[model samples]
Target: MGELVDRVDEQDRVRGVVDRGEAITHHWLHRVATTVCRDGEGRILVHRRAADMSRFPGQYNFLVGGAAEVGESYEEAAARELTEEIGVRVPVRFAFKFLCRGEISPYWLGVHDAVVRTDITPDPDEIAWHAWVTEDELREMARRPTFVADSLYALDRYLSRGEAARADPLP
Candidate 1:
């Protein structure tokens, strides 16, 4: 089993759900990733999803992330993915949440921000290309079909907040 999330109603009441396939098909799983990068620069790191990926192959994304493993919280998964995908231990502060429903996959994406001081070591199986881009550059890139919708939404939310240029350390 990959992982499962508790679907909730308007009042946040559990609706009883535990199927990844259904979650993807119906938009339910609460997955997370770290949109990590160098401190105070506000430059976002983008990655190219490997061509072998089951979903969104050869797509460009900013969050170094993955599905929340069973028994793992969103922050834990974000931290693990930051380390796993980029070789960085980032201080993951809550950034935003997204409910993405499309023909490809429906995933509840939890976006987290992390600042670090190290070079990245992307996993070849997961990432094909990588870059550190400015907000405007990312916005331009999002216009392309290769960018995932959920990630683009998340970046839009993050950039819309105007925190991308701040110098304060992530809490």
Candidate 2:
């Protein structure tokens, strides 16, 4: 068995447990948690996926996170991912979630936001390169083909919501 995740229905309700790989291979909906880190000035952190990653290698995204564990709530998973991926431990607020038709798989993406008041220590296994860019710069990044489509979708939704900070309206 691979990493266990809670398989979910279209309504985002827990259905059963499944291997992460199997869920992706079969297009089963599972929970993914991502945190968009912003500095005090609101510049967003964008990063390139590691070249050695099994998925989306060298691709770009405005967030950093991963699949939620079997019983982890979206917020817990987002906080956990922020620590694991970038070594930043801060309180993350629920921004929103949407069903993203990913380039490689389909999953319910729970997007969160964090203000990085301290330094970051990125995991080389997950992030290759990172930089903070203004929202206008991030808006330009959204047009790149090398970027993760699902991430762009998240970014688009996040920006469209008016306030950078908001709670998830989905159940």
Candidate 3:
């Protein structure tokens, strides 16, 4: 049996449940959660996906997460993914959410950010390599094709929002 995931509509409303592989193959809108981990020095954690993974194999991803299981909330999925992919359990802050239409999978991506003070033990099956990189360094790496598409999109959206927020101060 395959993993069961929640199927969502264009507006992110839960439609029903389906197998993860079927969701990907049919391009069904599904729930996905991603957690971006950062250190005290402001460096972000980036990891290379295992070469055998179905999507974005061997590509660098700044976020660690996966599809939300049936009946799981976005936050729950985010925290669970963080712990499963990297051996770190920390409080994650909700960052943003967006509809991501990728080549292999279309999902409603729930993005979260966390400051990890604990040590990380990446799962060898999910992550090939891991590192801490400055924002500038991440941007440089993202310019290449080695980075995951959805991650780059999410990062760009997050940074743009940060810039806009910094530019417009509340009176």
Candidate 4:
């Protein structure tokens, strides 16, 4: 069997459990938790995904995250994904959630924000290339041909919140 995922409904309620592969194969709705990571300088972390990844291979994504497992809250999933992908265990605050009409499958995306006070150890299997960029640089990268579409959506919504959204600004 493959990784188990929590299948969700239109309302974002858990409906049942399915293997992540099955969910993707059948186009079942699931919860995906991701984060926008920034450094102390407020530069966003942009990464080129490893080309061997099953989903969005070799794509440039601003958000780093994956499917929420069964019984995992979006926040929990976000924190876990951060640690798994970027080797960070910092406090991740929820930013927003949206149903992404992804290119491969549909899923609810839970977006979070976290400031990295420490250096990140990116897993080579997940991140092929990484660099911290200013918002303007990110904006330019977003226009690239290989950028992930869903991540672009998340970035748009994150920016829509303006500077007054989060209580404490990025450290």
Candidate 5:
């Protein structure tokens, strides 16, 4: 049996439940939770996916998370994924959400961000290498094709929103 995931519609409403594999294979819209973990020095944590993983193996990803389970809320999935992938249990706040309509995999992504004060221990099965990099460094890296598309999209969206917020001064 495969992992069960909540199948969502274009508006991110859960319509039904399906196996993760089937959802991916059929390009069905599903719910995913992503977390951008920042360190004490204000650097974002990124990791290289393990080469043996089914999707985007050996690629760098800015966020640490996966699909939302059958009955799990976005917040619960974010925290659970953080703990499962990076061995950290911290409070993650919702940043934004977007519908990623890719050719192969389409899903509604719930983007979250958190400042982790503790150390991170990446699971070898999920991550090959990890690093903490500044925004400029991340932008330089984004120039290359090594980073995962979905993660990059989320990061770009998040960064753009930050810039917009800064431009709007408080009255």
Candidate 6:
């Protein structure tokens, strides 16, 4: 299967310049994932990536995520990743999108934050463990453990601007 391709606009769109593979391999690609979780006060959930992951292993991170498959919508991918990673079924809402531009390739990332309440059985291949934290608790923990810098940034942006951050969330 091919990776989903979007047009090259500052915002996501369909353009004629690049093919899906080129954008993903040679260039930075756009992928979407959901941070499906809830808190201890029934507010939010947090998960940690397995320590053995190739990207950011053992990092405090989103509960579920994956690249959008060819012809798949961001919401669909988010929903699917959520189920695959954590065995949860929850409605996903568009929270934010991030661009991970590196010196080489760039990553067009869509981040959705969803609320869910259930026992999370993390896939050993994907995650190590998960927990729920209140907004205050998250703010506190963001200070210590190594987390997805982008996720923390999003949280700060959400708190400060009272609007979702327009900038790409750093990985």
Off by over 4 Å in 2: 164-171
TM-score of each: 0.81, 0.94, 0.93, 0.96, 0.93, 0.73
Off by over 4 Å in 3: 163-171
| lDDT winner, 2 or 3 | 2
Ranking by lDDT: 4, 2, 3, 5, 1, 6
Candidate 4 lDDT over residue span 1-171, tens digit each: 889999999999889999999988899999999988888877899999999998899999999899888999999999999999999899998989999988889999999999997999999999999999998999999998899987888888898888777445644
lDDT of 6 by residue, 14-133 (tens): 454345566756664555455545532345666788888755677785436866765677888888888888877777776667665633356556667666645677788988877777
Model 4 worst lDDT run, 10 consecutive residues? 162-171
Task: Give me the displacement of residue 133 in model 4, in angstroms.
Answer: 0.7
Q: Write one digit per residue (lDDT tens) for candidate 2, span 42-152.
A: 788999999989998998989889999999999999999999999988988888898988988999999987888788999999999999998899989879998987888
Per-residue C-alpha lDDT of model 3 across residues 1-171, encoded as one tens digit per residue: 599998889999988989989999899999999987888776889999999998899999898999889999989999999999998888877779999887678899999878787789999999999999988998898898889988877988877776443221211
Report the lDDT of model 4 for residue 132: 96
- Clash-forming residue pairs, model 6: 7-13, 7-14, 7-15, 28-106, 37-45, 38-44, 38-45, 39-43, 39-44, 50-58
Task: Tell me model 3's lDDT, rounded to 2 decimals.
Answer: 0.86
Q: Which candidate is the best by lDDT?
A: 4
lDDT against the true structure, per candidate, is 0.70, 0.89, 0.86, 0.90, 0.85, 0.63
> Runs in model 6 with CA error above 4 Å?
1-9, 15-27, 100-105, 161-171
How much does candidate 3 score in TM-score?
0.93
